[model samples]
Target: MLFSFIQSHDQNHIALRSNDHEITYGALLRQIDDYCARLTDVDVLGLALDNTIEWLLWDLAALKTETVCVPIPPFFTRQQIDHTIARAGITHMLSPAGLQATGQSASPTIPRGTAKITFTSGTTGTPKGVCLPASAMENVAHSIHTMLGNDFAGTHVCVLPLAILLENVAGVYSGLVAGCTIVLPQLGDFDANYSSLHHHLKQNAATSAIMVPELMRALLLQVIKQGPLPDLKFLAIGGSRVDPHLIKQARNLGLPVYEGYGLSECASVVSMNVPGHDRIGTTGSLLPHVQASITDGEIVIHHPGFLGYLGETAPGHHLTGDLGHMDEDGFVHVTGRCKNVLITSMGRNISPEWPESVLLAQPGIYQTIVYGDGDPHLSALIVPTGPHADVSACIASANETLPDYARIKHFRIVAPFTVENECLTGTGRPRRKNILQQYLSPLAVKETPMNFYDQLVAQTAIARAELYRVPQLVDGLQGRISRPTYIAYLTEAYHHVKHTVPFLMAMGSRLPDEKRWLHKAIIEYLDEEEGHEEWILNDIAAAGGDKDAARKAAPNLETQVMVAYNYDYITRKNPVGFLGMVFMLESTSTQIASMGADAVMNGLDLPKSAFTYLFSHGSLDIEHMKFFEKTVNQITDPADQAAIIEVATNTFRLFANLFGAIPHVSEVRDVA
Candidate 1:
């Protein structure tokens, strides 16, 4: 079918376009013929080239000659590349340099009629090879072409790497089958500069393209900053759960955008939102080649062409581990991954993707992974849009639309997940287990003797690191904050510190008789914390601010939320968790309070009296640390220890928010 499309088309028409090179249908057919002649003796061919004309030519040649083609992803590590080579049993390897023998002619026992072996970068361990026959690949391409109709026959730009199965089947083969001019730009050309990519697409008069959500985000941002590319018509985004709001934003800007769903197991595209048959939230209607049904809450595909894994026998149907349901309109609404589902301690099953989609749709969040398995509530690790994004507001807004159990109760701002970090898969899907291990895993305490205190510290190291990233804390510690900023910090501090004694008294009152030892420590904490808020008020006066107004002012939303969380935890959930707040506050004061006070006094030329609270708290917490360590180490109940750790982690994150809510010196100037 592909050959007939190529041969019957206008022979002089341009079929493939790279940087400056162009291949007409006649020339492209000759190149494929030459490659096929060369691969006659090769049973398995490994194409490891960039997204250039040569890569497409060799891939087509493999399809024509019935040779199993294994396209190696360039982002793969050396070990992964070697594993693919050995696992696929390649006879010949074709790279930019040239074709050479892999020195292994013993072909692996893949399923019969396997024409292409596409490897998926799974969440854990090595990549897995999915054997796909030419018929399956062609069926997907034909279905896409038929669904899209003649509107996409102008030009199709390849954005994602050709090695990705989505780009290989949907982008390249579909373009060929539709007799559209296929543009193959070097992956670096677009990846390095989205501005240049927009220009490249416009220059080529690109009418259609396929990309993952990550690339779509970049392109959308570029299109927003620059003008829209009027020539580009259809943009299909997949490879991960796309935030529906992102699609709406793109379309609102007059950029034709659509969302799709597929897996390599079923050959690229299973369902997609196209021009006339589009739906915003769902992943469009199913393609004609495949039929989907929800079996035990899993999206099972009755795709007969799937030849199964590299060595496994073909199953009756592909059980897509994704959890979703088909709507009355036949659109698929994917909720989340089955294996990635979080079953809370309260026996509620929560899919992270359900809340994740909401969070990602918000303005400030760039990427997020929701986690809380066997725990009381869900928490997220968010990658903000930029250094100064109002992520708290974003989470709060998203939570408004979610149910109580599905809301993100706690979140820690972290760096973006990327291919370089190994926390994100190549196709823009978060490696859930890898991300949890990297940012949220507790230390292996069994490897060494660690008390509860040590375990709490080790477990919350990441959250602590994230806390230190708050701009206000960073500036305050560096003595770069202005007088108003310092006053603001003091004001918020007074509001939360004023509750310290009250919180201690509440915890002491709520404790059972068996926890009298903990109650004793709470008494000591109350004694130390009783007059701390008064010290803050006096410092406000010493700093040339109104002490009366400072005391009358309400806490900001961040501080209020933190205080409320503690109050609820002490009164309702776990009274022992109050110790976690104590540990965070005192330990932090001991470490940085005095140092930061000295820096601020020296930098702002404020009198020592102005830092009364900070200096006194710093001095008082040194002894409190010794006491805290001893008391917490005495905790033996696993539930109590877990409560303490959870509270400590949340306190650090909340305190970070409190500090973050304070306006920076430059921000104040900007407002002025």
Candidate 2:
């Protein structure tokens, strides 16, 4: 039934494409038959194969053998893989290496018609297997075929992993049934890197594709920068709530993105918005085969759906655990997950998704998660549209539309969440528990202690204060500094500041488990230090120097050695010692650099823009020194303390040497 096109039309018609190879309908069916003969004894199989013709062949072979197949997501952790293997009672697994018998047949007991076992995202805990009949998944495909009408027959690119249920059912099965060629590229080719993905889509002349909201945002940015992807006619997006404003933006850019909603238990898609029957924001009306209703704000699906969770009894009805409603025209509008609802300390109930949608719709917001379960007011963790985006203004715009209780009272900008970091689910849902535990406490409180540790750190800083007064540095600064001397100073600063974030990242990564308390501080430091090197380049341009030449310039010997030595110290020796570099730099800035900015500015008669780096560091280091003191004070071990002091003294000596190396430019030479 799946390959009916082989009988009705040309058997040599291409069905699947990967790299430069194409599999025709005749070849695909023959491969499936060959695989079924080899795996006749296997009742249950697991697929850990990448996106390729082999993955599809194995899946079709399992269907022909009436065997239950489990498609394992490549992104799953080892622990999760083990859980799925044991729970699904997988007898064999097909991977890139080849098919191997798992020797794990604990329990094969499932509903009589079980064809595939799909797993949930497992954000909160262990993922539960949803056993679906072959017919149920096929039903979704048929409904999507009918929904799309004549527009269904075209090249469909599988942007999401095949293991994702949305792709498995709506993308693959639907495309196959409609007799459309499906392109399954390696997952890495299309993920995160938007420019490459857009290029691939254009090169392949992709007519339709499936994308998550995050990828859509990236593509939106790409389209805005580049031109439209005219060949890409249909884009089905789901897996998380989509921002309507993002949808609006995409439409304006000529991108054909349609929002839909589904879950594993529903056999992938329950509703979709097609060409004629479209709703801009809401997920379109439920497909013909399924029925849905809002029972006390919870989306309840009435259908003979999944058989049961693995090793568990089946429930009568599937409560999606999602709070949503049906609109006047039968479209399903989802707010957020029921479990994610927050009740304020004053007994004010709020759905974070409602306010979050408003926030994300604002121009600067790229990502946000709202929180206020027992707090006085709502707050959020935000990632802005770009490094220099005005998130505060976005928050202000979002607040104007929200009620007092639901509005964000405060928020902090954080690094973007991604699958590689385990902060986002495979399908782009935030792991709320992980995010809140890692960030909420640190962002909510000022964690610096004020005890003996603080006093000891203060004493250490005081002892190193004289490092700012090296004779060559003091004499050069005390006199009127010339243009060339100032330019040399900036060039060296660029060489070192360019490594600041990378070095901090290395230090943070290498820090021991006992140093867990310092992780938040390190991330905070990363946020501040990420692009300071660019400021130096801007200053060079403002000073009428060749910014391009300065960017390509090599670091002076002293500066290179200082950076190289500290990198070695962090990696080979104690990581805590690297903080000594911070102490040397910030202490010098706080003591002399702040005043030095004005002195050099007046002496050189350069614009204020020329001193962006110096002036920023001057004021910025005052607060940074305070944070550094608190962070260093928390180094309780005597061994750690000694390392910090030794490194600090050595770093000071290096700084003094770097200053001495810069050629003094007298005023007559500078003017000439």
Candidate 3:
């Protein structure tokens, strides 16, 4: 009932492409079957395998024994490795003579046949191991073949650490199942024999590969250095949402990175972005036999092949902390991580992601992060795409149409983003909190004078801005531990980031359809999200470098709120209010504009590069809100309209009142 797949004949084909070497699936399976026969009595197999071809063989061999395989991440510290080795009762370990992402050397941690413990990463750094039935890994391998096409074995390349589930399945098992060749390169030789890496990619007629965002970024940078790559057919990039701009750039450069969505617990490959089946930003449609739904914005999964957790929290189901929503077409689109969501004291729940993501969507901003949950404001940390370019123009360009609250206030430039170092995890996934603690927060908050945009907001200079609003919760308030004042009264307010939007939509509490229509129209009209950073630059260029001047001219918070209150009155408090009204006008319009202006003043080209982020949403969201108003008003039935107005007005009033009192919360001191 859980965790399984069947074998395919495609297994005789070339399976792996690495280090200028190749091993057919037939050869790979032969080796595995032989090893499995040897390990018939061994239960668990500890794979210390980095990313390589032998790792593939060993993985296959372990599976043939039906043993539960514990693949470790390359980034795990030696201490972590040992903790898991000891805890899991491993009798065997597999590793290369020299640890490497490539497959060239072979050193099974347990000389071939001994039962060994394998460890999976844990939150507390403790290792968890499951008893493996001899056919366990093979069962998983079979399922992989059933999924990726049994057509002549395809060339598979390892992009993530081989230790990751995605790579192990796609790079090893899939190839073995297809009867394809597997490749492995020597250790620590990527740069020196880098051509071998590219050669492996091209020579095996590399048709399939698995990559995390960081690897994609690395490859993208390599292409930027060496012009486009040749022969690569299918590339799966996931572990998180990729920069939309990077996606656009990759396609332009002839590198089609198919985005897939899955987690370690799902046995990987739940949803994949396949050619002709690609949805640029969407994680692509869910695969056959798997069930997925938006539970409070978080992805709840049910799969026929689900694994039993180390300690069975639930049966055949797992709630992945990744936040996402399904499109009307059934495509899965990831918004961000569930834990990544941060709600401020304001009644308004801000998706730092929705806005901050816009920065990465910007052309020159290679990487960008938005932060602020307990703090009074939102801030950004950025990494540039080019060498020594001004960021002001880019920021100014982005702010043109942004609302106030969502606009970035403080900013800092940082190093390029990567997953190789401890900066990123083995799967090429980012540990945002870790990043904040280690690199971002300490430097950004350093006594630097607040930027002009921050100065404007903190001082409440906008027309509708309240100079010193009292927060509903200030003294000793943070985290879910505290009773949420705004959320408590709203009754309908979200309990977790994952559920808020969907929950609101569920009780007939959705953003008005008209607003949705308007948003779609605006996005299409501006061709937004197509190369957002470039869009921002183009918009800023059109605006004539007076981005700050424009902000200075834009209506203040007071003015916008006046507009809102006036609009609210005209509508007689329609309960079916548009989310854009709160999202765009109140938040994006002022804050984004202010941020752009500040960046412009600070001599950065960020404004020009940030246009799509600010203007697209600002313009579209407002239109959406207006459409919502129209939709609410069209109900001539007085009762219905009256009811709608009551809900809208009440929601709006609560929103305003709660937000109005939020500017005064005490800074959160620690993680609760």
Candidate 4:
């Protein structure tokens, strides 16, 4: 009764779809019987075929013939393929090249009752095969069939590669047991195109599918652009951490995303969310046949252990290296992997998944990883969700919920991980060791003494210049905008500028003793920056606008928010973050002021008296930026550097928002 569908289901019912062809249950069984006859003598077989009906045939034939089977993922490197071949002592191989038997017919010794040897994702190290009993896998599939009941008996598409445990058990076995047609596709044809995947699903009229988190993200994005998803009965997401926000967004878009949790040792799925008993954040309640308990903060399953690694003894209780706890409602919640805990150089142990989850909570950051093992503080490598994504603001927002030690100190945008690039497992989990080897060299903060000022400037230049490229500011600087628009820009600038001295005073007063030298620098800045607001008033008067009226007017909403955030930064958050505000103003002034002043004067036909503030600051901030750079470089604390970079990034975004609020002219008229 392992494959009960063969005898229980109607012989004429369609059971499998592949290559534009359908196979009925009767036809599929006849094919499996023929295949099984050929494989009767083979003790162990390696399946390297794509996700196709042929793969199902191979698997079913092996199960019927009592031939041990090991699935070889196409993403595996040649070395990995060779290792699996030798380790499993595979006597026969089935791949695109067709089935061939090796000369070595001596079957390798595996644990008793071993039917399937499923490999882990192989992200961190060489993957170990987890031997599983056919009965156990069938037990899981039958449990799913019972829990889901008759409502889920629609066509199921194989989205993940057939080598994946989830698809093999949940997609193929359970779908058949539930009397649903299983649609199989070539792995290469699918690629990472979620639209194409969705199209394939619709074409086949598939009602259920299995997806990793990355695919879910792509599908969600496509749905956002297109429309709601098809009426899917179930869309299971697992193989990695599923962001709660991502799940919520997917559900809102009618994607029918249901998060789940499992491992290869647990026969693909131990817990999953179904229609009537779903929770947004939690993975799901445990399956009826599986027993999961937490001992010393690590999840241990009382289910059958792997038959054994090829040529090794089976370990007793399955200790899933993952950390989690059961909710009051019996729902399971996974925090992170126990093995992934990062021990900082400061002697504090932290888990990257905790903060990585917070970062993923923001819509702009599509994928991210945090690393600080043996370092003073943590840093991240991120992939943005879209071209116009504000990464800095997202990090700042995420940092609000994290502790100081666990907060991301620095981050850089990187290419998103994909199976094609070998940066991720067939499942969605990142290949942490490979990723560290590839990106760590450049992403890691260098301990060597160098000009960090230039480093900061060079790193932030493109994004900073983008702020000046805002359409309204660009036109204003070109003297092609109305005088009222320019007046509004100056109006907001005046409000922020007026608070400069007060902000500095607050920063200096709150400085920690270790950074008292920075306080001294702030005092010096205070002397030079005091009374700068009066100069804005003078410019307003010379431009033929009422200076008193501008002075008495309340600051615009954008300017008020910017100033309020700065005050909050210095008082409630780290006072050192105030330097970010300084960098925002001075660096921008040095770059734009002198050129802008000339452009404004010629564009407006303004008198020399009206331009004093712009022209003087244009020259003055050049020296000020040099001083600021030197002072920033002098601070050697990694935490301090992080604070400065974080604040500076946020300040630039706020400054852009402030500029964006002002109105621009409708017509392109030359000022002069």
Best by lDDT: 1
Which tens-of-lDDT digit does each residue in 1-672 have in candidate 3?
A: 111222344454555556556655445556667667756555555677656666666666665565545576676778878666555445556675532222122223322332222345533344454323333334445555555565535556554566666666655655655655555553354552133455556545566667766456656545533334556666778776765656875765457678878754555666766666677878888766568887877888864343343433325656777778898988888877666777765645676666655565444566676777876666777777675233443444344335766666667776655544345544434557666776654445452354322222232222222211123321211111122322121121111112323323332333356435334433342342234333433444443433334323433353345344534543554423333233223333333333223323222223334344454554554554444434434444444444433433343444445445333333222211
Tens-place lDDT digits, model 2, residues 639-669? 8887777777788778877876777744432
The TM-score obtained by model 1 is: 0.66
**Cα RMSDs, all models:** 12.6, 16.9, 19.7, 12.6
User: Per-residue lDDT tens digits of candidate 4, residues 82-170?
Assistant: 77787777889998899898655534577777888887756654777788888878988988888789898988989888888899998
Q: Estimate each model's TM-score.
A: 0.66, 0.66, 0.57, 0.66
lDDT of each: 0.83, 0.78, 0.50, 0.78
Superposition TM-score, candidate 2 onto the true structure:
0.66
Residue 504 shift from truth in candidate 4, angstroms = 31
lDDT computed for candidate 4: 0.78
